[model samples]
Target: AQSVSQHNHHVILSEAASLELGCNYSYGGTVNLFWYVQYPGQHLQLLLKYFSGDPLVKGIKGFEAEFIKSKFSFNLRKPSVQWSDTAEYFCARPRGGNTGKLIFGQGTTLQVKP
Candidate 1:
């Protein structure tokens, strides 16, 4: 079965610390990758995506990720994170075949202490 998994259920970090969240998928064919973040009281927004181009992709708010094809992983990283970066991060993939729905992993909650 095709699915996505986020290794961290919750994270706590001080401001200006480095951040890395693990993500892995179990699909063997072509797939679309996405990272969505929902801040406190805000709607989910696209952090980044990997779709047919370069495997290294950058997104809003100083976030980036690299897609490792052989490992089936797309891990999110940031050099220094701010308190505002605190939010729920969800890794999603578009369902393959005719259905265009999205499959989201159980989100990772990031808490940054100021």
Candidate 2:
């Protein structure tokens, strides 16, 4: 039995601010980590993911995440934020094997003010 947890409930920021969303998971074997974003009126889209490469993986919209096996954590980070970046983010990990089935965390809403 494995699950994902997102510690942040809601986050607010101004334009061009730094952003980081905490994400943790409970699993004992190799797992695929993912960060997904849902815009105001759009479908869920992937931000970044890490499987078996370098610990750090980059995604679209200037987003990146680091996979730390020792920590069982994969935190999302962005150097700067923009108004367009305002969205709900979810940290997810696959259930069982790498079959593309994801167990998502409690979503975190990010609001970027001007």
Candidate 3:
């Protein structure tokens, strides 16, 4: 079965702290990786994505993700995080043959303090 896994369920950091969230997928074939973020009281928003071009793709709010096909991993990273960055982040992939459907991993809650 294809699924996404996030190693950390919760993370705490102060302002200007570095952030890295591990995400791994269990698919042997091609894949499209995505990172979604849901701020407090906000709907999910696309953080970053990787399809086919460069392995490292950048997205909104200084966030970026790198896809390592050899390891079947797409990890999210940020050099420095702000208190406003606090949110629940999700790693997702489209279901096989159903691009409209997504399989998301158990979200990682990021609590950034001022």
Candidate 4:
């Protein structure tokens, strides 16, 4: 079965610290990768996505991710995080084939201190 896996359930960091979240997907065929973030009391928003072409993509809020096809991984990264960056991050992959459905991994809660 195709699914997304996120090992890190929670992370804590101080302001001006770097952040990296691990994400892996299990799917043989082509798939679209996405990172969604939900700030406190806010709706989920897309951080970044990788469909084709470039393996590395930049997203909103200075977030970036690299897609490794061989490893089936798309890890999210941020050079420096702020307290406002505290949120729950979700890694998702579409089921593909007309369904237009996305399977998300266990969300990771990030707490940034001032």
Candidate 5:
């Protein structure tokens, strides 16, 4: 079955520190990858996505991820994080055919201190 996994359930960091969250997927065929972030009380927004072409993709708010096919990993990273960056992050993959649904991984909550 196709599924996404986020390694970190929670993360804490001081303001201006670096950030990296691990993500992995188990799918053999073609797939679409996405990282969605939900701030304190806001709706989820797309952080990044990987469909085809470049393995390394950049998204909103200075975030980026590198897709590794062999490792089946797409890890999110930021050079420096802010207190405002604190939020819940989720990794997702679109279900193949028919449904047009998205399967989300267990979320990772990041707490950034000021």
Candidate 6:
């Protein structure tokens, strides 16, 4: 079965610090990738996604992800982050056959200090 893995389990950063969280998947076929963020006491929000086209995909709030087909990796990056960016991030992908089931990574918690 396909799965997602996040390199960092927890991250602490001060304001205006650059951030890069690694994400990799174990899949050999065509795939769609997504990054979701959940702020404190808030619902999961879609940070960014990469289905096709350009390898570099940008999303809301200065967030972006790159899809490297050769490496089976989709790493999220932000040049600078704010305290408001603190949250839990999850890397995910839909299961095969369009079952609507998603496989998510263990997740990484980012704590941004003011």
TM-score, one value per model: 0.95, 0.95, 0.96, 0.96, 0.95, 0.96
Cα lDDT computed for each candidate against the true fold = 0.92, 0.92, 0.92, 0.94, 0.93, 0.93
lDDT of 3 by residue, 1-114 (tens): 679999999999999999999999996556988999999999999999888989999999999999998888899999999999999999999877756588999999999999
| True lDDT of residue 86, candidate 1 | 95
Error of 5 at 65 (Å): 0.7
Model 6 ranges off by over 4 Å? none
**Global CA lDDT of candidate 5, please?**
0.93
- Positional deviation of residue 93's Cα in model 3 after best superposition, in angstroms: 0.1
Which pairs clash (backbone N, Cα, C closer than 3 Å) in model 4?
none
Root-mean-square deviation of Cα positions for candidate 1 versus the true structure, in angstroms: 1.0
Quote model 3's TM-score: 0.96
Model 3's number of clashes is 0
Q: Worst ten-residue run, lDDT, model 4?
A: 93-102
Tens-digit lDDT track for model 5 on 8-94?
999999998999999999966567899999999899999999999999999999999999999999999999999999999999988
**In model 5, how large is the Cα lDDT of residue 19?**
95
Where model 5 places Cα greater than 4 Å from the true spot, the runs are none
Query: RMSD to the native, candidate 4?
Result: 0.8
- For each of the candidates, the C-alpha root-mean-square deviation to the true structure, in angstroms, is 1.0, 1.0, 1.0, 0.8, 1.0, 0.9
Error of 2 at 62 (Å): 0.5
TM-score of model number 4:
0.96
Clashes of 6: 0
State how far residue 39 of model 4 sits from its true place (Å).
Answer: 0.3
